[model samples]
Target: MNNMSVELNYGYNGAIQPYNKQFKSNFSGFNHFEVGIRYMFSEHLGAKIIYKSDKFVNDPGGNIGIQYNSLGAGVVYNIGKKIGLTYLTRDNLGLLFHLEGSVGFANSLIQQYESEKTKIIGIGITPQYRINNKIAITTDFTYNINLKQLYGFDGFPINTTKISETGSFYNLSIGLIYYIGENKYHSDWY
Candidate 1:
């Protein structure tokens, strides 16, 4: 299987606010980004390392201007090929599902609150349409859970210091993936 590839993505992302009635700064925008490298050991399975950033901002954002940066690793499964559905779309379409784990830090642009770090676990689904032998267009959707998150996006501490407090977010993106090496077809499209 020809399976080395790189991906770039950009799109919208949002975080579910801290459930507390804290004066949370509103955050919204198209500030999600992802860059990753993938390597497949076989036709149906692969692994990847990715870097992701999500920036949330608003006019006069105050603490709303926050950036979350994460580095993650995942195992990928090509569902389309795994189930013997490669006959569709002239074999130009594919779907991938992944489970990932990451560790990252959140920084506030206003410099009022101390930066906080957290571990994250997420699930993602990507649908791809091949444009050529080497390139494909893709859309991705992911949901991530933030573990032991102690601060809100507004850069303020939550009402409680419980170590188990968690937060969640979702990312929706569109971008492209480029397969590398001299192969007639990438594992995604073959």
Candidate 2:
């Protein structure tokens, strides 16, 4: 058996921001991409770090966007032969649960200001189901606290607000895993 598998993932989050009386308008969109990678480890216990670029476009007047570069590490321990327990750790722990205090960064464009940086910190949760050796489904729920104000025009100072701006989104994804090599068996285990 091969110890490693590679995956190609594609999915979309329906609407990011709802229509509000306080804000300008509603934000809704779809993100699509094709990424390639190499995975190393076993299904019972493994870790993977991926790099992906995502592009988002909003409606009304603001074309707010971001380019995220992240590193994630995760482990899977088989409860029996078909059931498993999994945990993933990263700087952007938005897939864990709604909470406070975490560290992450992104370059954002709000309204017409395209040269601003925003720092995000929060906690989140993700639940995943392994359908078989070749497929799995995962859902992520995250709440993010934005450290910087929306770009374009600034009326307030950096330290004016006691609490940062909060944003949350959920994603459902289906992934296909492909084995790329041979598995190494330990004599101690057999």
Candidate 3:
């Protein structure tokens, strides 16, 4: 199989404490989305180019919303193969682990708040079920921390979020990955 793949995901996203007051819920519905390309150099090591977005809103009538968009580069590893799970891969199951760094902007979706530039760090794991040689289904959970964020989740100026003026958020997503190649099994399975 070849080494290229693309993924699309969408699900729930939320802002965590130190960035927001304890008054808002983190679950912002199905507004979180991600699309990315992946390439494996070997069965165990790889890299990804990603664009992800998350929208956050306060409770009904709360009149607050924020959106964050990011572009990331990350190192990925196939954990399924390393732990003697090649059998699972043969049976159409897989797992990946990643750590990424990103640069992006956050803005208030419905207010005059200015867009703020920020940097972020994230770690995640994805579990996959291959539906066929060319397609697979995956679920991912990622925890990310924002660095150099200048405002709080409420779109207000904040002195600092935490250490180094940072805030945190997370995403839980489901997606599809399409493999491009001419074999019955991609490197993830073969």
Candidate 4:
């Protein structure tokens, strides 16, 4: 069985902290996109690779924005019947929980900074509804934490002391998914 699936998604991304009220900064609406490939090694366990791009912007009259690019690999935990089995069974509709840790590089146009490596940890949940044997609609809610120090305009430090500081964001997305070499195998369909 080919236990592989690929997904393409687009959504809104924004920062949850350090909003810089003074500048009234925020994020560009619908400014994030992601591509992920998931391989189910076992029935209830697997791994996935993801790449995401996020762009932040300020409100009208504000002059601060940042862009984040990240690549992550993480463990995938499937939730459904055959939960304890090593071989995964496809369900027409199912839920998945994922936790991932990643290290990526960032660049800031406001501060004239080059590529700087940063660490991040993310946790998210995905709910999928199959449309047929190979197509489905999926929604994901994810939160990410930046583990390295963050800087703002003029090269000023925003979050100092690296891991000690708090720099985080959240994403809410909905997209379509296509499964390869698989059929709707949910218990409900049988």
Candidate 5:
């Protein structure tokens, strides 16, 4: 059986703030979009790989916006059937909850001067309502940490630069999930 799904997510992404003044500045009002593929191994366990794009501006009414791209893999823990819960609003309508953790890389542009790349770690909670056996609506809230290190300057009189820090961001997403299997989960014997 094909226990797979594809999803598209859209939501708000927090601004990227630099740790030091020597680095680039901060910007707000960012937007996010993501696409992913999920493989469900069981009724309560799944894995997902996703790619996300974030749009941000330098200042208010800025002409051009920077695009940040991130790719990650996460584990999903399903909690609907485990708690003996099923439909919520109507017949064939089911409510489900999931917890997820992920790790990946984020590539960002810090103006035309230099590029910034960071390792990202995130945790999220998703609540979904199944519209039918093949489709569902889901919303997720994820918190992400960006980790990077800056090296010291190469050579000078007595000059050196040292940089190593972690930044953070949060995302709230709403999306549709489409299933590609006859059942939500596969049998152990299969």
Candidate 6:
């Protein structure tokens, strides 16, 4: 059989907050979209490439937004025909992190400001369970490194915030897969 597959993912990101609430920066809640293609070398081995995009609004006053465009390539290993595990290496194609704080008046002076523009590369892993021929459940965990911190209105200059400590950020997702293909029939197997 020609074991090639294409998958698409649609999901949402919840729990949008900074690791430390004292930082006064947080991500906006948003929907995510991903598309990928996989080629199976055998029932036990395969490789895939994927692209993803995310958009959202931020907090504290001015609109906060984050955009992630990434390309990931990975290998998959199946446990029998019912379950599989995958490891991926992802590169952040483009990333933007923005934060804006509340404006104020001091002695008849008004201040306004916003922070923007940050990018990085990352890696991830995914584990999936197939319930049957056409349906499966999947989850993923991802971590990014050397990312620029969110811009602050009065604290840091553009691209001057503390760089993300390596191995500092990660994401988890759970979702379903629907396969579309014609089932093959073999006379000898029957």
- For model 2, residues 1-190, the per-residue Cα lDDT tens digits are 5555555555553334322324443333345332334332443344444433334345554455443333333343332222312323211111112233323334454433333344444343444454444433445433444454332112122233433354443334444445454434211011
Angstrom error of the Cα, residue 86, model 1: value is: 3.0
User: 1-86 in candidate 3: lDDT tens per residue?
Assistant: 68889999999886774445655455356779999999999888999999999877776644676778899999999998888576
Better of 3 and 5 by lDDT: 3
In candidate 1, the residue pairs with backbone N, CA or C atoms under 3 Å apart (3 or more residues apart, or in different chains) clash, namely none
Please report the TM-score between candidate 2 and the true structure.
0.49
Candidate 1: misplaced stretches above 4 Å? Answer: 19-26, 59-63, 160-164
lDDT, candidate 4, residue 118?
A: 73
Ranked by lDDT, the better of candidates 1 and 4 is: 1
lDDT of each: 0.82, 0.37, 0.82, 0.69, 0.58, 0.42
> Candidate 2: deviation at residue 119, Å?
7.3
Question: What TM-score goes with each of the models?
Answer: 0.90, 0.49, 0.90, 0.80, 0.72, 0.52
Give residue 39's lDDT in candidate 5 (0 to 100). Answer: 81
Error of 5 at 76 (Å): 0.4
lDDT of 3 at 6: 93
**Candidate 4: clashing residue pairs, number:** 4
> Candidate 4 regions off by >4 Å?
61-63, 82-90, 152-156, 159-164, 182-190
Question: Residue 188 of model 1: what lDDT?
Answer: 80
Which candidate, 2 or 4, would have the higher TM-score against the true structure?
4
Q: Per-residue alpha-carbon lDDT of model 6 for 1-190, expressed as tens digits?
A: 4466666666654323233344355443434666767666665566767666544334554243444455656655553333211222111111111111111110100124343334434455555555555555666555444244443222222244545322123445555555545654111010
Instruction: Report RMSD for candidate 5.
Output: 6.2
Clashing pairs in 5: none
